[model samples]
Target: MLKELEKEWTENDRRDEVASQDRPVPWTLLASLAALPIAAGLFVGGFFWWRGRPARGALSEEIAGLSMVSPWVIGFMAFTAFPIFLSLALSFCRWSSLTTLDHAQFVGWDNFRSLFGKDTTFYHALKATALYALLTVPTGQLAALIAAMLLNRESKWIGIFRSIWYLPGVLAGVGMSVMWRWVFHHEHGLFKTLIDPMMPAGWHFPAVFEKDAETWGVPAFAFINLWTIGGTMMIYLAGLKGIPKDLYEAAEIDGALGWKRFRNVTLPMLSPVLFFNFIIAIIASFQVFTQAYVMTGGGPGHATRFYVVYLYNQAFDFHEIGYSSAMAWLLLLIILGLTLLVMKGTKRFVYYEALKA
Candidate 1:
């Protein structure tokens, strides 16, 4: 019995020995792991402190400058940067604005594919917007330049005239649209009440906001947009004022008359301002929404259905927020490409040093 008990005790000791080999990790090792990051951080802080010791005063001023700009930095990160990145991410998602982001599903290129393949409204909106940009940019700039030329002279009434021209620019966008509605109101409008009677028999004014909208709607909007170019006119006026009078005098001496002086001297010198105006105007033209939204509500059919209006409809009207996000990115890419192309194509024409057009 004593021998058997000794053997059993020996067997228990062997099992315990084996269990000790599989013991929990050492506290020392865990403590070292926890301290490693703190040690590294301290080392980095010490190095930077030592390096900046000589320029401590400069370093403080830099910190102060950063402190002053921190609010703006924070605001941009919160408002602009976050939304931009979120929109980009959401473009790849099948998510509605009405739903929580947690509900988002990953759908790779389906949104973009639908945009290019199946959506007819997207194509119509794109085409209309492209045409509007093409028609308006050149004509609008020309009109603004002419208005500037007319107002660029010395006169007692110059301030009043300029104020008159620029007042329309500051008018509230919605108010302007409302006023235009009255002006184009089929029956009691400026055209219908006054000019329709003076027309030849069987002739009638075009219902640009309604029945004849498909034919004349975009052009009507383009014409109305002329009044808003007062700001552009003022810019052109400033550019005109900057042109060296000597250039015009030299042209005149070389038998260049009024038109010749304008063509040879004025246009070339004003090319920089022209370039600036073109870029701003083309962007504004593509993003045209308020007038189309208010005046005709994108109208009887897709007549005045501009790109942004259609995008807005897709988002709010149809609740295709993800699709709308895709459209937004697509428009951004298109505008960016067009801008690059224009910049490249007009590199020779945009005279920083007044090269002849």
Candidate 2:
């Protein structure tokens, strides 16, 4: 009986093996796998042929070049262009990222109206940003120009001095801001330690990081920015180097001494670099964020509340994405208007060498 049972089990296993061998393979999957290489080959061949083909005109060459960049163009449209337009649309709608698109309500110009008419913080942020730009831009430029003039020599140690001066600008951003926070600390801070001893008995240094920041915030921030004048100084140095020595010779021959030669020759020659730096400084000053955010946290009764910090608070902290978008657009408009005004106002002063020639 045991032998007969074992024989039956063996027969059953043999029948299962035969059935597995007779089963059909999936032709659809096999065809798809086979077609992949053919499709790839055809695409590659077509691309090479198009590239190697002789173009009839400049337009044809341009079209071919554009075709090669079609992928980047598509990506930019999908990622950058779409988001920009969506943000602009959302600026007019009451929407939150937490909600579905279908739930977004049309609010037209309500966001803009509220910011202008109702929000005091918006105005305060604008004022603070304007104040920061006013204090930092001219002072920073002047300091950088002076440093550049002082270091504009062809000595062996000049490169070392340039590198030393440039170190601060290179060390800018969040890390620098955090360092400044410690430096400006109310008690046991670097500035306090240095200035406290110099004061008379019972006299104290100004509380730069405290309530007095309402009066001193912008200037303090400007002082911090002044530390990073290395970059601007390098630009000024380059401009100074480019000024023809012949101009100085001519001025000296005309009995122009001391400040007179500088006013006539160096100032006009460096005007283009000055204008470039001015525009960059203005834009950068308007967008000041890191130091104010890290050091003051927009504190001292919103005295250091920069426009960007306010925008960030609205978008993330308050979950007012629509309002933030409106603020961003407003800031863009302000920068654009200021840039245009500056360009128009300084057109006469900006002496272009090519134009003069």
Candidate 3:
């Protein structure tokens, strides 16, 4: 009886030991594992739900959308908005690398007075830039229009000719400048060869390399701009292609031909396209820097001193960051004002058939 009791106790002890070895997991750890993915899912769902919520005002919607694109908004604020405001502030104060923020004194409109009232170079640069624009815009647009008309003709191998004309415009800037430099080379230049023989005795061509060439005020840069208009011509060509052939045929049937057909049908039809191209061309021409920089370096007595180039010199060369900032703002305002003026003027001229009564 004692042996049987002892055997029963041993079996019971063995069963309890085995049960303890296979222990159940802790409730805390099990709950944590279950909650992890559920918590993650809830967070993800809440983020998307917050993004698509309705807003109270237009500005609120804008802000919400901007929040969704917060990275870009942050970037714009840091890079563009902050810089502009800082510039405006800087323009009103005198600063230097050695000077701390406390050292910057309020100068009021002294900088503006210097730029407009005292600095003769500012007016000269403005005039040069304006002249460049006036010469380039009208001539380039006319040339492009003429080239487009010629290309629009339904003839064999016209595509080949169009491509040939546009090749110069597509050439790399350095390569184009180098090529143009050769073409305008005074001693062995093509223009020299063509024009020198036509002149009377004791007269040489107006040399851009020579001193006092600015006073001559010739259109040497104008021709360079004209040569670059090949690209613009191609864009105009594309615009011309969109005009229906039926319209031209209908005009021809109504006794429209030559200049009359062009004036009545082509011009009216192409007015919208012309307006768009005109604005683009004007904006581009006003920002003309590469050719002048590469070729002239604002030399020949600062004849080709473009606004952007001057601004660049002020910012980087002279370290007049504040002054440069002011110039940039001025440029922005001028461009904005001009664009608005052009749009207003174009309203009376540009015709759209879709919008017509």
Candidate 4:
């Protein structure tokens, strides 16, 4: 009986192996089936164009408009739209950069499950990213607004000051990262030299690249962020210039002075700009990668592994292209959700005069 059972199992394994050997994945057929909808869409579009064809004279300007913008539209379709849809499809399939697309084994929801299920690294990366965004966005905005307000004046040296402030922003990101690494060097960096002497005995400065760096790393990045407030400052300066002076005059008439005038007049008028900057800051902050990647490589044991950097490592370092693609899509969803939430929360506070109707 045992010999007969072993014989049956061996036969079943042989049959399964032969079945797999006899058939290969029909990627060509799959591709054709996948393209059928796109082909149908193009056909419908062509039909509509022919059916709704108007006199050339009526559409000359329209044609001219489309012709003028055709380059951008074409570029967007090729570079942006195509890759977006490709990534969406790839997210569901297990493929590596080293392998052909045809070799991608479809494993729907598995990548997402892994990310959410037992992947502690994913959670850590998410936490680091969220914390960095929270710490940097508001602080950077406040610093930028203050600098803008101080510089919003007519003077011979005002432009010089503006240029000086903006210079840091235009510097190469990797170069800046390298520079900051040295500035935060564990023992001999500028920070240690400047901050160590003031400390009491037995107290140590939080060396951002070394011991207990996790506690101080994100904050150090936030401090580095303050130095690159030039872009935000320019935007705030533009918003300040746009505010009607009469509003300030009215505030003065109403006995609203100093901070009261700013709160009542400046803030309401500038709310739209603030809203815009807030949205932009959130988007940019969540995608923070270069500085962390260059400085730490998400290390001292994944302490500073930010979202994008983690995604990057999954793709290139671990060869988990499918997982990384899922991570990218998840990030898109998160950003979109946050943006919508902020818009909903701030709608009443944002002073869109035209929208008041």
Q: CA lDDT, every prediction?
A: 0.80, 0.80, 0.69, 0.82
Give me the displacement of residue 94 in model 2, in angstroms: 1.8
Please provide, for model 3 over 1-357, each residue's C-alpha lDDT reduced to its tens digit, 9 standing for 90 to 100: 223423442343211122224333243554477578768987998787678766668658766686899898789968987677667766655444354555454555656665676556566778888887888789889998898878887878998988787877777486787776677776887767888889898876656544434853326677777767787787778777777889889999999999999888778878878888888887886677777767766655567777776676566655555556667777777788888999998898889882232
What's the CA error at residue 60 for candidate 1, in Å?
Answer: 2.5
What is the C-alpha lDDT profile of model 1 across 1-357, one tens digit per residue?
A: 223423442343211122223333233554577568768987998899667655778878877887899999989978987667567766766665687655556666767876787666677788888888988888899999999999989999999999998889889499999999889888789988888989999988888788898888898888888889899999999999988888778898899988988888888899999998999998889999999899887766778889999888768865666678888989889889888988999899888885232
Candidate 4 segments exceeding 4 Å error: 1-30, 354-357
Clashes of each: 0, 0, 0, 0
lDDT of 3: 0.69
Segments in model 3 whose C-alpha atoms lie over 4 Å from true places: 1-75, 96-105, 215-218, 354-357
TM-score top scorer: 4
Better of 1 and 2 by TM-score: 1
Q: Candidate 2 on 117-158: residue-level lDDT in tens?
A: 766777899999999999999999999999999999889998
Q: Which residue pairs in candidate 2 collide? A: none
Model 4 clashing residue pairs (backbone) = none
- lDDT string, candidate 4, 87-119, tens digits: 887787676678776777766686788678756
Worst 10 residues of 1 by lDDT: 12-21
For model 4, the run of ten residues with the poorest summed lDDT: 13-22
TM-score leaderboard ranking: 4, 1, 2, 3
